[model samples]
Structure formats: structure tokens, C-alpha cells
Target: MAWGITKKITSAVKKSAKGKATTASASALMAQREEARRTLLKAKGTWSQYDGHLVRGRQFLADVVEQKKTAHTDGTHTQADGELVDIDAYSHAFDDTPNRYSASVLELFLVQKGLMENSQGETYRGPYHFNSATAVVTGNPAQSAAVQDMMEVLKNNEGAEGGSRNHASAMTIEDMRKVMAWSYKQCPDELISLIYSRVQSESALDMDNVILAQKHLVIRAFATTGFTIWTRNFELTKIRRKDIVWNCQGCPPYDIPYDLLQDHEYEIYPQQQTPEICMFTHLRAWVNFLEEVLLRRPLEPDEFIFARVGANSVVYASDQLSYDGVMKMLAWMCKEVGLTARYTTHCFRRGGARYRFMFTPLGQRWSLATIRWWGAWAEGESKNHRDALCPIPREGDKSFNGDHILTAPITAAETQELKMSFDHELNCLSGKVEEVLDKLTLAPASSTYSSPLPAPSQPPILVSSPQSLQPTLCHQATISPFLESASTPSMIPSPVPVDSTSSPSPPAFPTTRALPSSSRQHGTTAKKAAPIPGVGIPDLPRGPEAWRTAVKQWEDPAASIGGKALKDWPEEWYTGPMRTITGVKRNIRKVIAMEFYRLQRDEAIFVEAYPEATCGVKPLFDAVQRQREGRSEITRRATYITLSRPAVAGTTFPGPTRALAQLYLFIRRHSVLVH
Candidate 1:
């Protein structure tokens, strides 16, 4: 009986130990779950404001739609002709009504329905689709004219006399600046002041100031970055206050680190983390805007940065601004600024690209590859898939590998050179415009001055008698200042003194001097010719009519003095031929180098025959030709026949191939002989 009691006691002890182990394991599991929750919450703190705003905005939108439906069923609301009202029009009505919550709610609805369309009738489904459209429209005639002229200049081959001809359309840095200036000028004064204020100040915002503060942030971000409306919206909706880096995720259940829970106030230098991605100052502005303005109160990870404040002063969370709404705002600004050019969201991207290309330091410039990567353009596996759907011949072959090969960073020296070049061009254009303006301003003075006619081909000889006078061959027209400067006595030398013996000497007239006639001449004296009226210094045309006449005279070869034909002078005298020659030489050298390289690939024959051709393949052909010159007479004769055989047989290759084949055969023959 005692042994049985001891066994029972041992069994009881073992049961208790097992139970204790189980309890410990359960406690550890719960503790891990709590830790995980805390880490997630810490990461959530970043995007919490944006997510809350988005959620509230969406909920409010649904409520509005439901309320409308309820009112309609209750006969409290009625439609005119039962027509479907445009959501954009309905949303715009609230702009001046002080119903900020209603406006935001409608915006969320429009965003969800994808009902926003720009002036071009192109639909903007999401924020990313919003591009340069905001800055595209320009109504100012002078600016528009300037932009058109710039476009023409960029698309044409420049002529010697500052004329241009149509070619392919291209954009330039000047064109981009024109557009940007228009946009900048068109922006509201209040918004501009707000942006400037935010950039200058470092003060934190109070809860009461949050609404106005966030608005300022949004404006500042958009103005500084030249980011597409959608990109800004996407970032604002997804980014968190403590999130130092934009991971390119639109919105998130983000990947958070466990250590983040320990230090809630930790921040990182965006410039150090993503040096080449975003501009430093712009990134700082963005971070400050988020922390000091939008995140003044508690927020959820999935909320939007912007929120709606109702007429009753109730603040509601809101989603992003509608693409269409932003476009309409841009259009309003364009109209206000008197800009007439058709602009869209794409303008921002183009302008930004041009700004970076022209103004940024060489080392800071972003390459095409970087743009494609950062912009989420199709590339790598995705690019392959896209290409397969619409295949382009040799598309894959055209792709370059590595950032270094694709684009080089701009250097400080290069930036300075570019700046100087751009400044010079701008100054030249400005000078021309100023000249035109000055002429217009002094219209009365121009009308009073009589324009001089085009000078005669040869100075008219005033005969002693009226019967001896000859009629002028060319008509007299007004001379332009340009023509007056161009036509000088140096252009046409005085006629060689006529042989006095062969020609009869005429009687001297007024203003004429006596010339020494040849002793064998008939008893008469040849007279020195007087200077012709308007020969060297012609009076410039001033008025509009005179200007038109001058232009006509300048263009017409028949009207010009000295019997010089217009066809003799090419439109592009100085630079055209030089460019053509440079291009031809470059192409020829490239072809020759390629052929020589190909020949050298035959290691056995190339090394044995042209041992001295180790430096480069280009010198190999010259060495072979030199060796051939020293060859026996018979061998030279044989080579000539062999080289001529292909052409004689009508089987010689054309272009670079023909040249390569001839060289290859000649080199092969010499190599065989040497071997």
C-alpha cells in the first residue's frame, strides 16, 4: 500500500511540471503578438493622416450620394428634364459656397468614378495621369507668339541670315521656360505668397491652423517640384510624416521595422538616402509640409494628407483632389493670366525634364534610365511584355545597358557653358524684339522720314546732253537698314579704266573731273566719274510700308546692285557645308574601322600577315598596302586582276561592303603570299 502511494505522488508531480511548461509557452506567444502590434502601429503613424482623410472623404462621398437618393425618393429633390448632371459641374458649384467638405466629398466621388476630363477631352482616371496640363495654356499673344517662333526655330535648320525652314518638331529649354513662366505668372497671388511663406518659415503649426497650413503645403509641393498633379496627390495620400524615403508605393500596409517602435521621433535625411532622386530643397519642403502642416493631429496610416472642412466648421477626412478639378483650376488661372496656348498635364513633365537638362550640374543630372525607373516607366521584364504586345523591329537590340552608358552626369563647367549659351541666345532674341518694339513706338517719326530706293546696279553716268542719258534698268525701292549695312562700295570695285585708245572719250559734265586720255586717242578728254547717289550709304526705311518694300528688295536678286545672283549665295553659307563634311568624314571613318576590326577577327591570318598591326585594326590595312607596294611585279599584277574581277563580274558589293570586300581580298592575298 505504501509503494502505491509513492507512485501516485510521482505521477501528480509530473502532471504539474507539464502544465507549468504549457502556461509559459502561451505567455511567450501573447507577448510576441503584442510586440508585433506595436511595431505595426509605429509604422502606421507615418501614413495615418493621409489614410484617415481618404477614408473619411470616401465615406462622406457615399453619404452624399445616398442622401441625394433619399431626397429624390422623398420628392424633396427633383432633376431638370431628368438629365444626368456632370459630377465636375456639380462639384465646381461648391467652390465659392464655403462648403469645403462638400467640395472634397464630390472630389472623392469623381476620383472614384474616374469622371475627370481635361480640355483636350482626354480622361484622367487617376492622379498619375495628371501631367503638364496645369501649365500648358498661355493666352498672352506676345508669349504665345514667342513660343510659336521658338518652336519654329527648334524645328528648322538655322540659316546664315537668321532664317529657318520647317523640319521635324523638337522642344528646347527656352520653350520650356516660356511655358513655366506663363504658369508661374498665372498662379494666384495668395497661393504664391503662401508658398513663399512656408519656404521661409520654420515654425510649427497649431491645431487651429492645420487646414490653411496643409493647403499651403500642397501648393508649395506642386509649385517647387514640377511634379504631375497625380504624383503629388499619390505621394500626399501615401507618405507618412516619419517616412524619410518615398518607396514608390502609392499607399500601403508598409513593411515596418521592429526598432521603429522604440524611437517615435526618428527622422532621416532624404537627400542622403536618395541623392539623385529628388531635389534637396524640394524634399525638405515636402518633409516640413508633411510634419508641420498636415500631420498636426492624430492620423491613421492609410489616411490622406488633405481633409475637408465643412460650412458648419466640422472637419472631415478626404481623399485626393480630383484630376479634373485641378485641371479646371489651371484653366481658370490661364484665363485670368490671358494665356491662350493649349496646355495639359504633360507640360509639367516636359518642362521639368528640360529644366534639369539645361540648368542642373553635370553630376546632378538624371539620365533617361533614371527617369524611366523613377517614373515607373515600362522596363526590364515589364518592358519585354509591353514590347511583345506591340513588337518593334530591333527594339531589344536598341536598348543600352548600365546608367553610365546611357547618360553621363553634367559637370559644373558644362553647366556654366550651357548657361552662357542659353543666355546668349535669349539676349539675341530679346534684342530683336526690343528693336521691333522701338520701331513701333516711334511710328510717327518713321512716317516723316522718306525711305531711300534700292541703289542702281551701276552708278548712272550723267551725260553732257539729255539724248545721251540711259534709262535705269532696276526699279528704285526703299532700302532696309539691314540692306544698307550689307551693300558697301567694297562689294563692287570701280570699273577698270576703259582702253582710251579703242573707246571714244566723252565730254565732261558737272561734278566730273578730267582724266588723262591715252595719247593715241582722238582729240577728246575722258572724264573721271562722279560718285553715284545712294551708292555706298543708302537711307534706311523707317515706316511699315517702307519696311515691307525694303524686305521685298532685299529678297529679289534682280533688285540688288552689282548684278550678283541670289542663287550664288546659299541660305546657310558658313555652317551648312562644314556640318555635311563633318558628318561624311565621321561616317566613312566608322565604316572603315568596323571593316578593319572584322578582318582582324581572323586571328591566324591577321597576326601572321600584319604583325605590326597590334596597336589597332585601322592601321592594319595601311600596313598591308605598304607591303604590297614592295611586292614583286608579278604578284602586284595578280592582285590587281583579283581585285578587279568582282566589279567586272557585276558581283562587287555596294557601299561600305564593297570597300570592305576589296580590302579583305587584297589583305588575304598578301597574307597567303607571306605564309
Candidate 2:
């Protein structure tokens, strides 16, 4: 009878599962009741025979779920390690936001791990899930509100949602906008404004619509720059996959931009282009919602593209950036990053042009004209003055830019070579000047007012070179005073005659920003000054344009003219020394030598002047003097200068004069030691 009852109950359950009313049938209900009675009787003699056990299990499960879902505001529990823990651990699992997993699964796992226990003791739950609460305690109220809004946006855009139950991996811009709008709904307008206004250059942001868009702007700025921040434009933008070509066929009808060529070389510098990697990392994470994920479709030209994250469904796209907008963004970033010194979005543009023109392997040295047309200078309209800011060189300095830079102390050996090269260059210019002056002085006067000198067999002094007469070609539109100085009027000054033997003292120093012409034959242009090779722009005294002409004419011997031409000539015909010694570097070593001399040659003065500087100067001085005289000291007191030694150790030194005395003594002693 019991087995028959169980069969009847099973049939009723199956019918119910199939959405039938089998359990409601009188015969079925009666059979179920009978089955229950038999089960109870069977359980009475088995492990599951405990009364109320089944009821307890259901109640426990319900209570467990309840505890997790309820909010806990206070922290009143302690762990096994006796550390205070927040009560939210059990409660937070119930939070509806950022809920990516099932509470049931979490509860079961916790129970298996012995983290929690059911009231009936049949199941265990893991540690309380409130660890995040401690971290959340420090969160800004504004941030919390913003996060909530973002959560709401996700809910509104279910298609992009990637919750625990939903394992969807793709997202789209429309979905992200939905989530972002929801997340910001509850946030204060001020905080919302802050997030939207600041944008970095790497990514496009709704710049006109947002407040406080600095974060986005900063990221974008970083993106536009080279891959590494410290290296300053060492990398270029990565080519998209579509640009890659596998064909080996030649003769494509159209020419590509210089940058697009695989191995194009600059005419000047011939270094090969280095490969660069893409800077963007995860494409999906950029947008917060899964519904916003892309479907991974191939890109097609002219297809409109929108940012993955925004408040709007439609966004304008552009292959080229709006120059004005980008400049404003760049200025904002420069201020944001505290780099008031070197940030200009346009700087990157100019830098791109310069990097191509100056640094590339097909390295072509750009003419000023080419630089102006690169679109960089058009935006730099206000900085027109910078074109003429030529770097100046010191007298006799042969360095490329005329500037000598020594990061650390240079050795005497290096100095000697530097000095030799510097002097040689100075001498060469000075000699040329003298030679020109002599020729000028010997010429007879031939002004329109004065009678012409007897016709000589030599040619005229001002004859033009064939090369100078040709029209100057420029690749870029050159402007500014420097360019004008080089082209409009010859950069070289007109040469005047003078007496060679009575050459005047050189000028204090010569510095000119005026550029020398690229050619001399075109009288409209001046001769190009020989740049100190290997150096960039530098300042140097300009040579007279007519010097070459004068030299040629002087050699001809028929060009000499006028009485007392040298009388009107300026005194300083030659440029003075390029670099002068700093008083410190010059005086320090000399002082050492002077001190040694005093110690060896004048013991009385050394002892008196540097009484506190030495412990036994008199005796040491005697020894040094004796050593100098090929004799030995009579006293055996050990004496030598050390870091702690008082140069005036024996007495209270007066003002700076005492210091000077010590310096002198030190020099004297040093000189003796060296000898």
C-alpha cells in the first residue's frame, strides 16, 4: 500500500511540472497525503527522521538571503584575528548596484568555506562581504552620487549591460551614453561640470557640452605626444590596419605623403624611421557599459564614427582636427599639467614638421620657406618675432652655435685643444680682414667727384660672381627680419678700406641675428655665413658682404681708390676673444701656486698672513724652503693641509683680507708641491 501511494504522488508531481492540475484531482490529493504519511513513518527510523528538520532548512535559507540583502550601517563584529570588521560584509552582497553574481551561489560558497552558519547548523556561509565598506567610507559624497548615476545609466541601457548572469562581451557607444547619463543624473551639477570640461588629447570628448573636462583632455594630450613622455616626439602615429599593403607591384599613380612612405629618406639626415606601436590599450573599457561595446566590424572610409562613451547617440566625426579647438584644448592641458614652460598643442604640429624635416633619415634640412608652409607657423602668427632670434657666438669661439657648454668640470687637456681650435679660427678671420684692408688702402680714389685713377690692367673691385646673379629659389615662404636680412639686403656689411699695419683693436664682442645669403652672385642676396658645422642656430658677428668683393678687387690691383681711406675706418676691425675665463676658475689654481711659493720662498710672510690657516706654517714653510734649497727641515713636526685644518688656526682672523691671505698661502704651498 505505501509503494502504491509513492507512485501516485510521483505521478501528481510530474503532472504539476507539466502545468497540469493533477495534484488538484481528488484521487491524486488523497494519494499524495497517503505518500506523506508513509514518508514520515519511514523517516522516523532513519537519518532524516528528525522532526521539523525540513522546515528548518527552508527557514535558514530564507534568513541567509535576508541578512545579505539588508543594509548594515554599523560595524560591530570582530574577526578571528581580533580585528574589527564592518557588519556590511554580510549585507553588501544584497546591493543591487555592481551586482555581477548570484547571491545564492555566493552564499553557498561562503557556507562551504565555513565563513557563515545557518540557524539550523546544516549549512555555512563565508566571511561577511563588507570589505569594500572600509574603502567606501573614504569616498567623496560627490563621487558616490556620480557612481550611482552611472549605475542607473547601465540599467536603462540593458543591451550594453554585462552583469554576472549575462556574460555578453560586446558594447557600443549608444549603450555607454545611456549608462553615463544615468550615472550622472543624481550628481550635483558642479561635479558633473568638472568631469566633462577637462579632456585629454588622446581621445575625443564632447568639449563644448561639458564642464571640468581636464581628465579627458589630459589623456588626449598624452596620446598625441610620442609613445613615451620623456623622449619628446620620438614616435609617430601608428598606421591603421587598412593602410597596410601586401603588394610588391610598383608604379602607383599617385604619390603618398612623405610620412606614409615606408622608407623615405630626408635629403639631409639619412636615419631610418623607427617602428611605433599603438598607444590605445583596451577598446571596450573606454565605455563603461557592455551594451556600448562594438560589434567588431571592419572599418570603412566615410563611415561616421563616434566615441564609445558620451551622453549623446550621435557625434560628429572628423579626419582632421579643428585647429582652434585643438589649440584651446592644448592650452588647457598645459595649464593642467603644470608645464607652463613647454606645452603647446601646436608645438606638436610644428614638432611633427621639424621631426620630418630635420631628424628623419631622408633627413632634409628645411629652408625657412618650407617651415612656414607646414601649417605650424600659420597658427603661430603672434610669435613672428622668434624667427630672428639667432643664437650668438662668442669671439674666437669655433663651436657650431658659438655657445660652449660644459656640463661638468672639463680637464686641462680638453681645454687646451678647445683653445687651439678657437684661436685658429679667430686668427683666420682677423688675417682676412687685414688682407682686405691693405688692398683697400693701396687703391687710388675714384669717386665721381675725384679724378679716376690711371686705368690699370686689373679688373674692377665690385664685379659680381656668376653664381650670385641667379634667381634664389625657396621651398617655403620665408618671412621675418632674419629672412629679410639674408635675402632682401645682403647680410654682409659693405667693406671699407683701411691701413693693414694700423689695424684697430678688435670690438668687445660681435653678435648678429642677421642671416647670411645662400648665394653671393645675386647682389640681391648676401653670402651664406659658414655655420659652425654640426651645430644648430647660433649667433656670430656678421662678416661684411663686400669683403669677398673687396678681396677680389684688391687682388686685381686696379680697384684701389681715394685719399686717406683708412682714417674713416672704425677702430675695432677684428672680433675679440669668444670666451673669457671666469674669475674663479682663473684665480683658484693660481692661488694654489702662489701659496706654495709663499711657503717655500717667504716663510715669515706665510706664517704671519696665514697664522690660523696652518698648525705649524713656520716649520712647514722652512721644510718646503729647505726642500726648494736642497736642504732638510731641522724640526721634525709633521705638517700638511687637510679638510679640517685651519689656515689661520693660530689666530683670530680679521675680515675678508684674512681669507685672501689664507688663499695666497694655499697657492704658495701648492706651487711648491707641484715643483
Whole-model lDDT per candidate: 0.37, 0.32
TM-score of each candidate structure, all chains considered together: 0.24, 0.16
Cα lDDT tens digits for candidate 1, 1-675: 334545654776699866753355888768855655555445656557756666755565556656676555542443455645444334334343645346545655666556443333433222222237685433434345566788777657465365553332222334434434443343333333343344346533233334443443454444333432113332433443333334322111222221110111111213332222223344455445554434445445544433333433243444444566455544654565455554455544554555444555454565555445434452452332111101111233544322243355766776676667655654564454332222111111222221111123333322121222332121212221222232211221223467758973321111121222221254433453332211111122323233222333334444322123222323232123322222222222322233334466465554566664454423443454344335421122111213322121111221222333333433332332222
> What does candidate 2's lDDT look like per residue over 240-327, in tens digits?
2233222223212321112111211111111122212111211112221111212224434333222222234222222323334444
TM-score, cand. 2 vs. native: 0.16
User: Which one is best on TM-score?
Assistant: 1
User: What value of lDDT does candidate 2 attain over all alpha carbons?
Assistant: 0.32
Model 1 regions lying over 4 Å from their true place: 1-217, 223-295, 298-300, 306-318, 336-339, 345-366, 381-675
